[model samples]
Target: MASGKPIDEKVRSEIITKIRDEGMTVTEASNRYDVGKTAIYTWMRDGVVNSTSSLILENNRLKKENEQLYNLLGRATVELKKSKR
Candidate 1:
């Protein structure tokens, strides 16, 4: 039977976490949390958008770090060449 009540954000987050981080399947989470499979699927879709945003941010940060490392290496190479000359 449906609870006929809204699930709270905290509970929703826990359910999502279990599915994403704990390797729980959608069916398992739906059963364990007493939520509908459709709701869990919707949550997973929404989470993918958020995860994509986070991945973009992380990729930008890594690009900057890589650029800085390349610059540092170039400077070190120049200094090494100067010392050799």
Candidate 2:
């Protein structure tokens, strides 16, 4: 609970969750939990970067899947046209 001291991982997670999910302000959490504002800000920034990375990977995967589906549809359409002719 002190600055420069190692905080427990569960407690750190709870503090971050309070700031994010419960809408607790950085100043408030710092004061309430006796943590430094800088530490909390760092945690938030790290979380954002990690989340963005995950989103980018997921988006890329979905794009590939969509392209594959389109290719399959195009092939099916071509086969249908040939059968009709």
Candidate 3:
């Protein structure tokens, strides 16, 4: 930090990503970066990171899988119709 304050923005972001995105605990991230737990908690309080990204990725992946399955079902339906005729 420029002054006797918290960590820099880049460092804070990295800490957030390491903890939230990489699934590391606050304690783990603190120890890995040698930062204090209080600082991590403060950044979290300011909404520096959240669990929404993980959920969004999971939802998008599931949506893609669902679309593929729907396409497969449609193709199977068409094949069945042709076989019956």
Candidate 4:
């Protein structure tokens, strides 16, 4: 397959499943399917390729937002302590 050409979602899912459940190597699958190895690895790591589920995407977004909020809170707390000292 051409690198620029998009593969069907179902096919991509199958490929990922094969790599995960069948113990196939990233390189082997990439070579067999003509897909980029990085893309295959990403699919395996993420559990879904080109994710269409809004919930998954929303969860990821929320996680990042939560991290930022925590970091901001920490910084504010440190500033408050320093100002009080």
Candidate 5:
């Protein structure tokens, strides 16, 4: 027998919402909805998650920390050079 008919936009939106809200893994979602993992990944990459998404917030935080660390290192290098002169 053939696979069931393709799901509609409503169902697709619900699935995407579930994936984002529940932090469901692509593999789990694929198995549950009979959707391909690649399709799920494509949805995620296509802006399914909002700007205030936790992952994006955490990424921004990490980038800020990285810049701070680099600035500190540069200052330390400058101090070392002055001390050596």
Candidate 6:
């Protein structure tokens, strides 16, 4: 079946809102309205859930924590080995 025209942002948002607001799955919406999974995904990527700040902050925090843990572990291991000898 040929879907007549491309679904616009408003219509896509409505579908997404139904899924989000009513707890409907994309597959369920797709089946119910003759939409496709790809279409739903395309709509999802059209600037929804896009975040920059949290991801950058999270990466920086994880990097600092990892470096601190690595240094602490290395120092503790060296001290333990020195004490044993």
The RMSD of every model to the true structure, in order and in angstroms, is 4.1, 4.8, 5.4, 7.8, 7.6, 7.9
Model 5 lDDT, full chain set:
0.74
The TM-score measured for candidate 6 stands at: 0.46
Per-residue lDDT tens digits of candidate 3, residues 35-69?
Answer: 88878888777666344445567899999999999
Deviation in angstroms for 60 in model 2? 13
> Could you arrange the candidates by TM-score from highest to lowest?
1, 2, 4, 3, 6, 5
Q: Which stretches of candidate 5 lie over 4 Å from their true place?
A: 1-5, 48-85
Compose the digit string of candidate 2's lDDT tens values, residues 1-85.
5568876766777888788889999999999999888888887777634554576689999999999999999999999999999
Put down candidate 6 lDDT per residue, 1-85, tens digits, no spaces: 3285776655766777788789999888888878887777766666333343345578899999999999999999999999999
Residue 57 CA displacement from its true place in model 1, Å: 6.5
Q: Give the Cα-based TM-score of candidate 2 against the true structure.
A: 0.53
Off by over 4 Å in 4: 50-85
For model 4, how does the per-residue alpha-carbon lDDT over 1-85 read when each residue is reduced to its tens digit?
4477887888788787777789888788888988988777766667666563555688999999999999999999999999999
> Any idea how many clashes model 5 has?
0
TM-score-wise, the better of 2 and 3 is 2
Error of 2 at 79 (Å): 19
TM-score between model 4 and native? 0.51
Model 5 residue 5 lDDT?
Answer: 64
- Candidate with top TM-score is 1
Predictions in order: lDDT? 0.80, 0.82, 0.78, 0.79, 0.74, 0.74
Between candidates 3 and 5, name the one with more favorable TM-score.
3
**Count of backbone clashes for each model?**
0, 0, 0, 0, 0, 0
The CA root-mean-square deviation of candidate 5, after full C-alpha superposition on the true structure, stands at 7.6
Worst 10 residues of 5 by lDDT: 1-10
Segments in model 1 whose C-alpha atoms lie over 4 Å from true places: 48-85
